[model samples]
Target: MITITTADAIIHTLESPEAIADIPSPNTRAALQAAYDAGHWELYEPPQAEPEPLPPDWPAFRLALLQSASFRLWSEALPATWREDLKLAAIAANAEALQSIYTHCTTLHSPGHTAATEWQQVADHHRIPITF
Candidate 1:
Protein backbone atom coordinates (compact mmCIF):
# COMPACT_ATOMS: atom_id res chain seq x y z
CA MET A 1 0.00 0.00 0.00
CA ILE A 2 1.48 3.34 -1.07
CA THR A 3 0.58 5.31 2.02
CA ILE A 4 1.32 8.89 1.02
CA THR A 5 2.23 10.18 4.46
CA THR A 6 3.54 13.55 3.34
CA ALA A 7 0.20 14.81 2.01
CA ASP A 8 -1.37 14.72 5.48
CA ALA A 9 1.58 16.60 6.95
CA ILE A 10 1.28 19.27 4.26
CA ILE A 11 -2.39 19.90 5.08
CA HIS A 12 -1.65 20.21 8.81
CA THR A 13 0.84 23.00 8.14
CA LEU A 14 -1.49 24.92 5.81
CA GLU A 15 -2.92 27.13 8.56
CA SER A 16 0.49 28.17 9.91
CA PRO A 17 2.93 29.57 7.39
CA GLU A 18 5.73 29.04 9.86
CA ALA A 19 4.66 25.46 10.51
CA ILE A 20 4.92 24.32 6.88
CA ALA A 21 7.94 26.51 6.43
CA ASP A 22 10.27 23.57 6.96
CA ILE A 23 9.11 20.23 5.67
CA PRO A 24 10.68 17.47 3.58
CA SER A 25 9.64 18.85 0.19
CA PRO A 26 10.23 22.51 -0.62
CA ASN A 27 7.76 22.45 -3.51
CA THR A 28 5.05 21.05 -1.27
CA ARG A 29 5.65 23.84 1.18
CA ALA A 30 5.52 26.43 -1.59
CA ALA A 31 2.25 25.01 -2.88
CA LEU A 32 0.78 25.30 0.60
CA GLN A 33 1.93 28.89 0.78
CA ALA A 34 0.39 29.59 -2.60
CA ALA A 35 -2.86 28.10 -1.35
CA TYR A 36 -2.73 30.26 1.73
CA ASP A 37 -1.90 33.35 -0.32
CA ALA A 38 -4.78 32.49 -2.60
CA GLY A 39 -6.96 32.08 0.52
CA HIS A 40 -7.99 28.53 -0.39
CA TRP A 41 -5.86 26.66 2.09
CA GLU A 42 -8.73 25.52 4.29
CA LEU A 43 -9.74 21.88 3.98
CA TYR A 44 -12.83 20.61 2.23
CA GLU A 45 -14.67 17.31 1.86
CA PRO A 46 -13.86 15.97 -1.58
CA PRO A 47 -16.75 15.15 -3.85
CA GLN A 48 -17.84 11.52 -3.80
CA ALA A 49 -16.72 9.82 -6.97
CA GLU A 50 -17.73 6.42 -8.30
CA PRO A 51 -14.23 5.85 -9.70
CA GLU A 52 -12.25 8.99 -8.81
CA PRO A 53 -12.04 11.76 -11.35
CA LEU A 54 -8.79 13.61 -12.18
CA PRO A 55 -8.71 17.35 -11.64
CA PRO A 56 -8.32 19.52 -14.73
CA ASP A 57 -5.32 21.40 -13.37
CA TRP A 58 -2.36 19.87 -11.55
CA PRO A 59 -1.09 22.92 -9.60
CA ALA A 60 -4.54 23.71 -8.21
CA PHE A 61 -4.99 20.01 -7.54
CA ARG A 62 -1.83 19.90 -5.45
CA LEU A 63 -2.97 22.70 -3.08
CA ALA A 64 -6.37 21.25 -2.25
CA LEU A 65 -4.78 18.26 -0.53
CA LEU A 66 -6.52 17.69 2.84
CA GLN A 67 -5.91 15.82 6.09
CA SER A 68 -7.06 12.63 4.45
CA ALA A 69 -5.24 14.06 1.46
CA SER A 70 -7.79 13.01 -1.05
CA PHE A 71 -6.57 12.81 -4.67
CA ARG A 72 -8.85 15.56 -5.92
CA LEU A 73 -7.68 19.18 -5.69
CA TRP A 74 -9.46 22.51 -6.19
CA SER A 75 -8.43 23.12 -9.81
CA GLU A 76 -9.84 26.65 -9.67
CA ALA A 77 -7.28 27.69 -7.07
CA LEU A 78 -4.22 26.70 -9.09
CA PRO A 79 -1.89 29.51 -10.09
CA ALA A 80 -1.36 30.37 -13.70
CA THR A 81 2.16 29.33 -14.50
CA TRP A 82 3.98 27.30 -17.10
CA ARG A 83 7.23 26.85 -15.27
CA GLU A 84 8.97 23.63 -16.26
CA ASP A 85 10.09 23.15 -12.69
CA LEU A 86 6.49 23.23 -11.49
CA LYS A 87 5.18 19.72 -11.01
CA LEU A 88 2.65 17.95 -8.79
CA ALA A 89 3.79 14.95 -6.78
CA ALA A 90 0.32 13.61 -6.08
CA ILE A 91 -1.34 14.27 -9.39
CA ALA A 92 -1.25 10.60 -10.32
CA ALA A 93 -2.99 9.59 -7.09
CA ASN A 94 -6.64 8.52 -7.15
CA ALA A 95 -8.87 5.52 -6.51
CA GLU A 96 -8.44 4.31 -10.06
CA ALA A 97 -4.68 4.54 -9.83
CA LEU A 98 -4.68 2.71 -6.50
CA GLN A 99 -6.91 0.01 -7.89
CA SER A 100 -4.67 -0.42 -10.89
CA ILE A 101 -1.60 -0.67 -8.72
CA TYR A 102 -3.43 -3.09 -6.45
CA THR A 103 -4.33 -5.22 -9.41
CA HIS A 104 -0.67 -5.32 -10.42
CA CYS A 105 0.28 -6.37 -6.91
CA THR A 106 -2.32 -9.11 -6.88
CA THR A 107 -1.17 -10.41 -10.23
CA LEU A 108 2.43 -10.46 -9.05
CA HIS A 109 1.37 -12.24 -5.88
CA SER A 110 -0.37 -14.91 -7.92
CA PRO A 111 2.95 -15.80 -9.61
CA GLY A 112 1.44 -15.05 -12.96
CA HIS A 113 4.24 -13.28 -14.76
CA THR A 114 2.37 -12.62 -18.00
CA ALA A 115 -0.77 -11.40 -16.29
CA ALA A 116 1.24 -9.24 -13.96
CA THR A 117 3.04 -7.75 -16.94
CA GLU A 118 -0.30 -6.87 -18.48
CA TRP A 119 -1.47 -5.22 -15.29
CA GLN A 120 1.83 -3.41 -15.03
CA GLN A 121 1.42 -2.15 -18.54
CA VAL A 122 -2.03 -0.83 -17.74
CA ALA A 123 -0.72 0.92 -14.66
CA ASP A 124 2.21 2.49 -16.50
CA HIS A 125 0.27 3.45 -19.60
CA HIS A 126 -0.64 6.88 -18.26
CA ARG A 127 1.15 7.52 -14.97
CA ILE A 128 4.01 10.00 -15.36
CA PRO A 129 6.26 10.56 -12.39
CA ILE A 130 6.52 14.20 -11.32
CA THR A 131 10.02 15.59 -11.81
CA PHE A 132 11.02 18.65 -9.82
Candidate 2:
Protein backbone atom coordinates (compact mmCIF):
# COMPACT_ATOMS: atom_id res chain seq x y z
CA MET A 1 0.00 0.00 0.00
CA ILE A 2 1.25 3.47 -0.91
CA THR A 3 0.53 5.42 2.20
CA ILE A 4 1.20 9.08 2.90
CA THR A 5 2.19 9.31 6.56
CA THR A 6 1.90 13.10 6.85
CA ALA A 7 -0.72 14.29 4.41
CA ASP A 8 -1.38 17.56 6.18
CA ALA A 9 2.29 18.39 6.14
CA ILE A 10 2.51 17.46 2.49
CA ILE A 11 -0.55 19.59 1.72
CA HIS A 12 1.03 22.53 3.49
CA THR A 13 4.28 22.00 1.65
CA LEU A 14 2.60 21.62 -1.73
CA GLU A 15 0.23 24.49 -1.07
CA SER A 16 3.11 26.88 -0.60
CA PRO A 17 3.27 29.60 -3.28
CA GLU A 18 6.77 28.53 -4.19
CA ALA A 19 5.65 24.95 -4.78
CA ILE A 20 2.89 25.77 -7.27
CA ALA A 21 4.64 28.67 -8.96
CA ASP A 22 4.46 27.14 -12.38
CA ILE A 23 0.68 26.65 -12.53
CA PRO A 24 0.24 30.07 -14.19
CA SER A 25 -2.69 32.49 -14.00
CA PRO A 26 -3.14 35.30 -11.44
CA ASN A 27 -6.66 34.04 -10.72
CA THR A 28 -5.24 30.93 -9.13
CA ARG A 29 -3.27 33.02 -6.67
CA ALA A 30 -6.24 35.15 -5.69
CA ALA A 31 -8.48 32.14 -5.27
CA LEU A 32 -5.93 30.34 -3.12
CA GLN A 33 -5.30 33.41 -0.97
CA ALA A 34 -9.00 33.95 -0.44
CA ALA A 35 -9.47 30.38 0.76
CA TYR A 36 -6.55 30.76 3.13
CA ASP A 37 -7.84 34.06 4.43
CA ALA A 38 -11.33 32.74 5.04
CA GLY A 39 -10.12 29.48 6.56
CA HIS A 40 -12.69 27.75 4.39
CA TRP A 41 -12.63 26.71 0.77
CA GLU A 42 -14.25 24.64 -1.95
CA LEU A 43 -13.01 22.92 -5.02
CA TYR A 44 -12.67 24.83 -8.30
CA GLU A 45 -15.13 23.98 -11.09
CA PRO A 46 -13.79 25.06 -14.40
CA PRO A 47 -15.97 24.32 -17.40
CA GLN A 48 -13.18 22.74 -19.38
CA ALA A 49 -12.28 20.18 -16.79
CA GLU A 50 -14.07 17.10 -15.57
CA PRO A 51 -13.57 14.75 -12.65
CA GLU A 52 -11.61 11.65 -13.45
CA PRO A 53 -12.83 8.08 -13.10
CA LEU A 54 -12.33 6.53 -9.69
CA PRO A 55 -10.37 3.42 -8.88
CA PRO A 56 -11.54 0.27 -7.09
CA ASP A 57 -11.45 1.65 -3.59
CA TRP A 58 -13.12 4.96 -4.46
CA PRO A 59 -16.46 3.97 -3.03
CA ALA A 60 -14.84 2.89 0.20
CA PHE A 61 -12.93 6.13 0.40
CA ARG A 62 -16.03 8.17 -0.29
CA LEU A 63 -17.84 6.14 2.30
CA ALA A 64 -15.11 6.85 4.75
CA LEU A 65 -15.38 10.56 4.09
CA LEU A 66 -19.15 10.45 4.43
CA GLN A 67 -18.82 8.46 7.61
CA SER A 68 -16.16 10.67 9.16
CA ALA A 69 -17.25 14.10 10.33
CA SER A 70 -13.73 15.41 10.50
CA PHE A 71 -12.85 14.49 6.91
CA ARG A 72 -16.14 15.85 5.70
CA LEU A 73 -15.54 19.15 7.42
CA TRP A 74 -11.95 19.42 6.29
CA SER A 75 -12.77 18.49 2.73
CA GLU A 76 -15.56 21.02 2.69
CA ALA A 77 -13.12 23.65 3.88
CA LEU A 78 -10.47 22.91 1.29
CA PRO A 79 -9.38 25.74 -0.97
CA ALA A 80 -10.43 25.90 -4.60
CA THR A 81 -6.88 25.43 -5.75
CA TRP A 82 -6.53 22.42 -3.55
CA ARG A 83 -9.68 21.03 -5.00
CA GLU A 84 -8.41 21.62 -8.49
CA ASP A 85 -5.12 20.05 -7.56
CA LEU A 86 -6.97 17.03 -6.31
CA LYS A 87 -8.90 16.83 -9.54
CA LEU A 88 -5.71 17.14 -11.53
CA ALA A 89 -4.06 14.55 -9.44
CA ALA A 90 -7.03 12.34 -10.11
CA ILE A 91 -6.68 12.89 -13.82
CA ALA A 92 -3.03 12.02 -13.54
CA ALA A 93 -3.72 8.87 -11.56
CA ASN A 94 -4.84 5.43 -12.56
CA ALA A 95 -8.49 4.43 -12.25
CA GLU A 96 -7.48 1.81 -9.69
CA ALA A 97 -5.33 4.24 -7.73
CA LEU A 98 -7.62 7.24 -7.29
CA GLN A 99 -9.10 6.23 -3.95
CA SER A 100 -5.79 5.64 -2.28
CA ILE A 101 -4.51 9.07 -3.31
CA TYR A 102 -7.70 10.98 -2.55
CA THR A 103 -8.53 9.36 0.75
CA HIS A 104 -4.91 9.27 1.81
CA CYS A 105 -4.40 12.97 1.30
CA THR A 106 -3.41 13.33 4.94
CA THR A 107 -0.67 10.81 4.35
CA LEU A 108 0.97 12.86 1.53
CA HIS A 109 2.14 10.05 -0.69
CA SER A 110 1.54 9.93 -4.47
CA PRO A 111 1.46 6.90 -6.75
CA GLY A 112 4.76 5.71 -8.11
CA HIS A 113 3.57 5.24 -11.68
CA THR A 114 0.36 6.96 -12.67
CA ALA A 115 -1.51 8.56 -15.55
CA ALA A 116 1.07 11.32 -15.68
CA THR A 117 3.86 8.80 -15.93
CA GLU A 118 2.00 6.89 -18.59
CA TRP A 119 1.22 10.02 -20.58
CA GLN A 120 4.75 11.18 -20.27
CA GLN A 121 6.28 7.87 -21.09
CA VAL A 122 8.09 9.44 -24.02
CA ALA A 123 10.46 12.26 -24.81
CA ASP A 124 7.74 14.26 -26.57
CA HIS A 125 5.54 14.19 -23.52
CA HIS A 126 7.78 16.70 -21.75
CA ARG A 127 6.03 19.64 -23.39
CA ILE A 128 3.87 20.02 -20.32
CA PRO A 129 4.01 18.30 -16.97
CA ILE A 130 1.09 20.37 -15.72
CA THR A 131 -1.45 19.21 -18.30
CA PHE A 132 -3.51 16.27 -17.09
Candidate 3:
Protein backbone atom coordinates (compact mmCIF):
# COMPACT_ATOMS: atom_id res chain seq x y z
CA MET A 1 0.00 0.00 0.00
CA ILE A 2 1.10 3.59 -0.70
CA THR A 3 1.18 6.26 1.99
CA ILE A 4 1.12 9.79 0.57
CA THR A 5 2.45 12.58 2.83
CA THR A 6 1.67 16.14 3.96
CA ALA A 7 4.22 17.51 1.48
CA ASP A 8 2.69 15.59 -1.41
CA ALA A 9 -0.77 16.80 -0.46
CA ILE A 10 0.28 20.45 -0.20
CA ILE A 11 2.13 20.49 -3.54
CA HIS A 12 -0.78 18.88 -5.32
CA THR A 13 -3.08 21.48 -3.82
CA LEU A 14 -0.84 24.38 -4.87
CA GLU A 15 -1.97 24.16 -8.49
CA SER A 16 -4.92 26.40 -7.54
CA PRO A 17 -3.67 28.75 -4.80
CA GLU A 18 -6.22 31.50 -5.32
CA ALA A 19 -9.09 29.83 -3.44
CA ILE A 20 -7.12 29.05 -0.27
CA ALA A 21 -5.71 31.72 2.03
CA ASP A 22 -3.25 30.31 4.57
CA ILE A 23 -1.58 26.94 3.86
CA PRO A 24 -2.05 24.27 6.53
CA SER A 25 1.06 24.36 8.75
CA PRO A 26 4.48 25.98 8.52
CA ASN A 27 6.22 22.56 8.59
CA THR A 28 4.04 21.17 5.84
CA ARG A 29 4.48 24.38 3.85
CA ALA A 30 8.26 24.10 4.18
CA ALA A 31 8.23 20.47 3.10
CA LEU A 32 6.19 21.41 0.07
CA GLN A 33 8.62 24.15 -0.85
CA ALA A 34 11.56 21.79 -0.38
CA ALA A 35 9.90 19.15 -2.53
CA TYR A 36 9.22 21.74 -5.22
CA ASP A 37 12.88 22.79 -5.15
CA ALA A 38 13.95 19.11 -5.38
CA GLY A 39 11.47 18.50 -8.24
CA HIS A 40 8.97 16.16 -6.50
CA TRP A 41 7.44 15.26 -3.15
CA GLU A 42 8.70 12.35 -1.11
CA LEU A 43 6.38 9.52 -0.17
CA TYR A 44 5.43 9.40 3.50
CA GLU A 45 6.19 5.71 3.52
CA PRO A 46 8.08 4.19 0.64
CA PRO A 47 6.07 1.55 -1.16
CA GLN A 48 6.40 -1.97 0.14
CA ALA A 49 8.68 -4.11 -1.99
CA GLU A 50 6.59 -5.85 -4.63
CA PRO A 51 6.64 -9.62 -4.56
CA GLU A 52 8.93 -10.88 -7.29
CA PRO A 53 7.31 -11.82 -10.58
CA LEU A 54 7.05 -15.56 -11.02
CA PRO A 55 8.75 -17.05 -14.04
CA PRO A 56 6.10 -16.49 -16.65
CA ASP A 57 4.17 -19.35 -18.01
CA TRP A 58 4.97 -19.41 -21.74
CA PRO A 59 2.29 -17.05 -22.98
CA ALA A 60 2.83 -14.30 -20.45
CA PHE A 61 6.58 -14.43 -21.11
CA ARG A 62 5.95 -13.89 -24.80
CA LEU A 63 3.90 -10.77 -24.20
CA ALA A 64 6.54 -8.94 -22.10
CA LEU A 65 9.13 -9.64 -24.79
CA LEU A 66 6.96 -8.35 -27.62
CA GLN A 67 6.30 -5.19 -25.66
CA SER A 68 10.02 -4.49 -24.95
CA ALA A 69 11.56 -1.91 -27.23
CA SER A 70 14.77 -2.65 -29.20
CA PHE A 71 16.53 -0.10 -27.05
CA ARG A 72 14.51 0.33 -23.89
CA LEU A 73 14.57 3.99 -22.84
CA TRP A 74 14.44 3.04 -19.16
CA SER A 75 17.52 0.83 -19.40
CA GLU A 76 19.43 3.14 -21.74
CA ALA A 77 19.63 5.95 -19.20
CA LEU A 78 21.71 3.81 -16.82
CA PRO A 79 25.47 4.42 -16.74
CA ALA A 80 27.50 2.10 -18.98
CA THR A 81 29.13 0.44 -15.96
CA TRP A 82 25.70 -0.50 -14.62
CA ARG A 83 24.26 -1.70 -17.93
CA GLU A 84 24.95 -5.40 -17.41
CA ASP A 85 23.73 -5.15 -13.83
CA LEU A 86 20.31 -4.19 -15.15
CA LYS A 87 19.81 -7.78 -16.44
CA LEU A 88 17.68 -6.75 -19.41
CA ALA A 89 19.49 -9.33 -21.56
CA ALA A 90 17.38 -12.12 -20.14
CA ILE A 91 14.28 -10.12 -20.95
CA ALA A 92 15.52 -9.46 -24.46
CA ALA A 93 16.24 -13.16 -24.97
CA ASN A 94 12.80 -14.12 -23.72
CA ALA A 95 11.25 -11.57 -26.03
CA GLU A 96 13.23 -12.92 -28.95
CA ALA A 97 11.99 -16.41 -28.18
CA LEU A 98 8.43 -15.16 -28.01
CA GLN A 99 8.71 -13.39 -31.32
CA SER A 100 10.26 -16.49 -32.86
CA ILE A 101 7.44 -18.64 -31.51
CA TYR A 102 4.82 -16.28 -32.85
CA THR A 103 6.49 -16.09 -36.24
CA HIS A 104 7.00 -19.85 -36.38
CA CYS A 105 3.75 -21.06 -34.87
CA THR A 106 1.07 -19.79 -37.23
CA THR A 107 -1.73 -21.19 -35.06
CA LEU A 108 -1.28 -19.78 -31.51
CA HIS A 109 -1.94 -16.07 -31.92
CA SER A 110 -2.83 -15.06 -28.34
CA PRO A 111 0.18 -13.29 -26.86
CA GLY A 112 -0.29 -14.58 -23.30
CA HIS A 113 -0.75 -18.27 -24.06
CA THR A 114 1.91 -18.34 -26.73
CA ALA A 115 4.52 -16.65 -24.53
CA ALA A 116 3.84 -18.95 -21.59
CA THR A 117 4.22 -22.07 -23.71
CA GLU A 118 7.51 -20.90 -25.21
CA TRP A 119 8.78 -20.14 -21.71
CA GLN A 120 8.24 -23.73 -20.62
CA GLN A 121 10.79 -24.85 -23.19
CA VAL A 122 13.34 -22.57 -21.48
CA ALA A 123 12.28 -22.87 -17.83
CA ASP A 124 14.44 -25.88 -16.92
CA HIS A 125 17.85 -24.28 -17.42
CA HIS A 126 17.25 -20.56 -16.91
CA ARG A 127 15.09 -18.59 -14.51
CA ILE A 128 13.70 -15.16 -15.30
CA PRO A 129 15.55 -12.12 -13.91
CA ILE A 130 14.14 -10.64 -10.71
CA THR A 131 14.51 -6.91 -10.07
CA PHE A 132 14.12 -4.89 -6.90
Candidate 4:
Protein backbone atom coordinates (compact mmCIF):
# COMPACT_ATOMS: atom_id res chain seq x y z
CA MET A 1 0.00 0.00 0.00
CA ILE A 2 1.21 3.48 -0.76
CA THR A 3 0.87 6.02 1.97
CA ILE A 4 1.73 9.72 2.00
CA THR A 5 2.40 11.31 5.30
CA THR A 6 1.32 14.93 5.14
CA ALA A 7 1.00 17.71 7.64
CA ASP A 8 -2.70 17.02 7.85
CA ALA A 9 -2.84 13.23 8.25
CA ILE A 10 -1.74 9.81 7.09
CA ILE A 11 -3.05 9.36 3.57
CA HIS A 12 -3.56 5.89 2.10
CA THR A 13 -4.46 4.82 -1.39
CA LEU A 14 -7.89 3.23 -1.37
CA GLU A 15 -6.56 0.58 -3.73
CA SER A 16 -3.92 -0.50 -1.28
CA PRO A 17 -4.81 -3.74 0.51
CA GLU A 18 -3.72 -2.19 3.79
CA ALA A 19 -5.89 0.87 3.29
CA ILE A 20 -8.81 -0.72 5.09
CA ALA A 21 -9.74 -3.96 6.77
CA ASP A 22 -11.67 -6.64 4.92
CA ILE A 23 -14.22 -6.61 7.68
CA PRO A 24 -15.39 -3.67 9.69
CA SER A 25 -13.32 -2.99 12.78
CA PRO A 26 -13.70 -0.23 15.38
CA ASN A 27 -12.50 2.64 13.18
CA THR A 28 -13.11 0.86 9.88
CA ARG A 29 -14.77 2.52 6.90
CA ALA A 30 -16.27 5.18 9.08
CA ALA A 31 -12.88 6.31 10.30
CA LEU A 32 -11.37 6.15 6.86
CA GLN A 33 -14.25 8.06 5.39
CA ALA A 34 -13.98 10.65 8.08
CA ALA A 35 -10.31 10.98 7.45
CA TYR A 36 -10.96 11.30 3.75
CA ASP A 37 -13.50 14.02 4.40
CA ALA A 38 -10.91 15.73 6.53
CA GLY A 39 -8.24 15.30 3.83
CA HIS A 40 -6.23 12.77 5.80
CA TRP A 41 -6.00 9.64 3.68
CA GLU A 42 -5.04 9.83 -0.02
CA LEU A 43 -8.26 8.25 -1.11
CA TYR A 44 -10.85 5.65 0.03
CA GLU A 45 -10.87 3.11 -2.79
CA PRO A 46 -8.93 -0.03 -1.93
CA PRO A 47 -6.80 -0.43 -5.05
CA GLN A 48 -6.05 3.00 -6.44
CA ALA A 49 -5.36 3.59 -10.08
CA GLU A 50 -1.87 4.67 -11.09
CA PRO A 51 -1.44 8.32 -11.96
CA GLU A 52 -0.66 9.32 -15.55
CA PRO A 53 2.83 10.21 -16.71
CA LEU A 54 4.08 13.75 -16.77
CA PRO A 55 3.80 15.74 -19.96
CA PRO A 56 6.88 16.26 -22.13
CA ASP A 57 7.11 19.86 -20.97
CA TRP A 58 8.08 18.80 -17.47
CA PRO A 59 11.76 19.43 -18.20
CA ALA A 60 11.01 22.92 -19.40
CA PHE A 61 8.95 23.57 -16.35
CA ARG A 62 11.77 22.21 -14.24
CA LEU A 63 14.25 24.47 -15.94
CA ALA A 64 11.98 27.39 -15.30
CA LEU A 65 11.88 26.44 -11.64
CA LEU A 66 15.64 26.65 -11.35
CA GLN A 67 15.55 30.13 -12.80
CA SER A 68 12.94 31.44 -10.42
CA ALA A 69 14.01 34.21 -8.11
CA SER A 70 12.58 32.24 -5.26
CA PHE A 71 14.92 29.39 -6.00
CA ARG A 72 17.92 31.67 -6.25
CA LEU A 73 16.80 33.45 -3.13
CA TRP A 74 16.33 30.19 -1.32
CA SER A 75 19.74 28.97 -2.38
CA GLU A 76 21.33 32.14 -1.11
CA ALA A 77 20.19 31.28 2.42
CA LEU A 78 21.85 27.87 2.37
CA PRO A 79 25.45 27.16 3.34
CA ALA A 80 27.83 26.84 0.40
CA THR A 81 28.06 23.02 0.91
CA TRP A 82 24.27 22.61 1.08
CA ARG A 83 23.95 24.70 -2.06
CA GLU A 84 26.02 22.11 -3.92
CA ASP A 85 23.79 19.35 -2.60
CA LEU A 86 20.76 21.21 -3.89
CA LYS A 87 22.42 21.58 -7.25
CA LEU A 88 23.11 17.86 -7.46
CA ALA A 89 19.60 16.96 -6.36
CA ALA A 90 18.16 19.25 -9.01
CA ILE A 91 20.07 17.30 -11.63
CA ALA A 92 17.70 14.38 -11.07
CA ALA A 93 14.89 16.59 -12.46
CA ASN A 94 12.26 14.31 -10.95
CA ALA A 95 8.99 15.79 -9.79
CA GLU A 96 9.60 15.00 -6.16
CA ALA A 97 13.13 16.27 -6.29
CA LEU A 98 12.07 19.58 -7.78
CA GLN A 99 9.40 20.02 -5.17
CA SER A 100 11.88 19.13 -2.43
CA ILE A 101 14.31 21.68 -3.79
CA TYR A 102 11.59 24.28 -4.03
CA THR A 103 10.51 23.60 -0.50
CA HIS A 104 14.04 24.21 0.64
CA CYS A 105 14.49 27.22 -1.61
CA THR A 106 11.35 29.17 -0.81
CA THR A 107 8.67 29.49 1.77
CA LEU A 108 6.02 26.78 1.63
CA HIS A 109 3.47 29.52 0.88
CA SER A 110 5.13 30.62 -2.34
CA PRO A 111 3.17 30.06 -5.49
CA GLY A 112 4.01 28.23 -8.79
CA HIS A 113 4.69 24.81 -7.37
CA THR A 114 3.48 21.71 -9.18
CA ALA A 115 0.13 20.26 -8.27
CA ALA A 116 -0.42 16.78 -6.86
CA THR A 117 -1.79 15.57 -10.19
CA GLU A 118 1.29 16.78 -12.03
CA TRP A 119 3.51 15.13 -9.48
CA GLN A 120 1.79 11.79 -10.07
CA GLN A 121 1.93 12.15 -13.82
CA VAL A 122 5.62 12.96 -13.87
CA ALA A 123 6.33 10.20 -11.43
CA ASP A 124 4.41 7.74 -13.58
CA HIS A 125 6.28 8.90 -16.65
CA HIS A 126 9.72 8.88 -15.04
CA ARG A 127 9.54 5.75 -12.96
CA ILE A 128 13.30 5.31 -13.01
CA PRO A 129 13.81 8.63 -11.27
CA ILE A 130 11.32 7.76 -8.55
CA THR A 131 11.84 3.98 -8.68
CA PHE A 132 8.66 3.34 -6.72
TM per candidate: 0.22, 0.24, 0.21, 0.31
Q: Deviation in angstroms for 107 in model 2?
A: 12
lDDT of 4 by residue, 2-68 (tens): 3433344555455553545552675555666556455554434366788996544545544654655
Model 1 segments more than 4 A misplaced: 1-15, 43-132
Measured on C-alpha atoms, candidate 4 has an lDDT of 0.52
TM-score, candidate 1, is 0.22
lDDT string, candidate 2, 59-87, tens digits? 34334435555444555565665655665
Scored by TM-score, the top model is 4
| Tens-digit lDDT string for candidate 1 (1-132) | 011124335444233456666667888766666666656555444557698644344334344333112121222123323111122223555544434543443333342455445433433443422211
lDDT of 4 at 38: 56
Candidate 3's C-alpha runs over 4 A off are 1-45, 57-95, 107-132
Error of 3 at 54 (Å): 1.2
lDDT of 3: 0.43
Candidate lDDT scores, in order, read: 0.40, 0.41, 0.43, 0.52
Question: Which candidate wins on lDDT?
Answer: 4
For model 3, the run of ten residues with the poorest summed lDDT: 102-111
Better of 2 and 4 by lDDT: 4
Instruction: For candidate 3, write residues 1-132 as lDDT tens digits.
Output: 212234445434443322223556776556655555555633345459999966545444435544555224433544553444324444465545444433433232222444445444444324543211
Which pairs of residues have clashing backbones in candidate 2? 4-107, 7-106, 7-107, 55-95
When sorted by lDDT, best at the front, the candidate numbers are 4, 3, 2, 1
